[model samples]
Target: MPAPPPHSAGIPASRRAQIGAGLSDSLGVGLGIFPLGIALGVLVVQAGLPWWVSPALAIGVFAGSVELLLVGMLAAATPLVTIAVTVLAVNFRHVFYALSFPITRVRPGLPRAYSVYAMVDEAYATYALMPAEKLSSARMVTGQLAMQLYWVGGGLLGVWVAGALPAPIEGFEFALVALFIVMTLDALRSKREVPSALLAGLAAAVALIAFPQQALLAALIMFTAGLALRYAVTRGAAHA
Candidate 1:
């Protein structure tokens, strides 16, 4: 049998427009995510997981960080309930992302579903940077589709590359730590966030001193509660 054609000349004109828009919009983000996806694919294989898990998580879960952590948990035979809770806690921020996301701008049905499914951080950032007039269903959906393609394809390629490795690779776990550090530094750059950063540092210190074995989760809970309480007190004092 012959291989398929290189181009989408056989596709309809309207569909082609969607494809073109998606490809163009995805260019900047695709460059960044493609390598990360490949790294994730490598991580999965290094974690002793089957290669297909990478694409499965990318296509199904669509969360790079959670998926990377999950591959390790799964390899360790973590319980389903524990995994579910961790996923919820880690991705709870997406609920807030959905509030301001341009999901409504896309046409309803499959395109809309695709928009929601592909609503990653990069997609949200892309939408934010795009001109209001350029926002359209085809552009939005196709952009997401292109990104998924890069991720899924890179994951498959990573698995193949991992299979060729002579021995187990080291240093993959540092990716998660590095990402969190970058994000923390980014969050701390704003003047208004300085107080919150200080509070977080205090919370981390307390959690570490108190719950050494569960410092991360304890610190997150303590920090969130402290922030909430502080907000409530400030509001009450202003009203009084």
Candidate 2:
């Protein structure tokens, strides 16, 4: 007769090593955003905004694109509806991500909801790249926990240091834009990702031209169209 299956307790030593590696990968991914986080901190002070809000948003929202938008939106006194709509549209991809993430295999409960809430773009990317054989529940959770701490810690550090920086240093708001460009370029390097980005950009531009009041909505429409196109192409290839 066969022995009992290896439960969570029976995860091999090699698998444990993979979990440690995944955690490290998540940390390295988070480190890439340190400079940008610092820039956000400086901007918080320069914008005459409350510094405490930076870490709170990082802890709560943790969405980089929307956080940057909030900077300008705050100064413009953009309505709550606009902010809410924009953030939801920008992060709409997360809805799809939640469908297939391996962590779901781990059987999450209430703690899983909170963990899933903390799953930012970087975490998703790293977790998505994790090898199937190596993706254990222990490993996924460890990676996500490490990533969340790095993000929150970096933002907090930025907010604290922002208060002490000289006025002249506060002029680096462009760094935030530069960071977004870098991330965009990296993601768009692949042919598969390029179309989606181009579509989103075109939509944003068109919206800016035709419906400035609803630019976010227009971009979202384009994003939906792009995803639809991608799905059609994938299905065609599958049938071929």
Candidate 3:
């Protein structure tokens, strides 16, 4: 008899469909991540660290924007306490993302944990686009896994490209800023989000001018609090 079939082939048609959708949805996500990953890899080398650091951050931290900031800090030889605080401030938004994202499809234990760990902005945006009826636990997890692979793979490729270059290229470090700009524009497609985005931008500008020493942390705190208060007031007004 032939050897046992591979696992993917044995999955149900519906499950297969779900997996395919997940992979397909990740294409646009990969477009954004790949360049950013390349920038990160180049930045890693520019910072005078080993090539391994880029992929290591992509795999270990799995955060794009924050990892960019970390690269700068590592280069400056910044203190660990400041780095810790900055990381917490930047990543604190994930707490809110977790609040609304549906993870019921993920089975318990490590699988479920990985699903949560993989909940980057791209995954969140894709999940929000799908109707409840169209989503399956298998599909959701598969799509997230695919996106993570794209990001990790992109970082590794960037590392390779950086190594191949004759000398470190200047200005590639700005890719992180460009990536965030693109993400913000994509997110602002909804009219309802425009106000919040503007508010956050205002907060960032203020922090940049008034609190340059701790700009990112200050901007994030202001944005978070301002948005929370706006939502609460809106809800209260609606009920009244």
The CA lDDT of each predicted structure is 0.82, 0.73, 0.82
lDDT measured at residue 204 in model 1 versus the true structure, 0 to 100: 89
Regions of model 2 farther than 4 Å from truth: 1-22, 168-170, 184-202, 212-240
Instruction: Evaluate residue 71 in candidate 2 and report its C-alpha lDDT on the 0 to 100 scale.
Output: 76
Question: What's the best-to-worst order under TM-score?
Answer: 1, 3, 2
Q: What residue pairs clash in candidate 1, if any at all?
A: none
- Candidate 1 wrong stretches, greater than 4 Å: 1-15, 202-216, 237-240
Off by over 4 Å in 3: 1-14, 180-240
Q: What lDDT does model 1 reach?
A: 0.82
Q: List the residue pairs that clash in candidate 2.
A: none
TM-score, per-candidate, Cα-based: 0.83, 0.73, 0.75
lDDT of 3 by residue, 1-240 (tens): 999656675787677887898788888888888777877787888888887888788888886688888998888887787688878877877888888788776677876798899888888888965778877777788888888787777777888888899987888777777767887998899899899899999999999999998777678788888999999999999999
User: What is model 3's C-alpha RMSD?
Assistant: 4.1
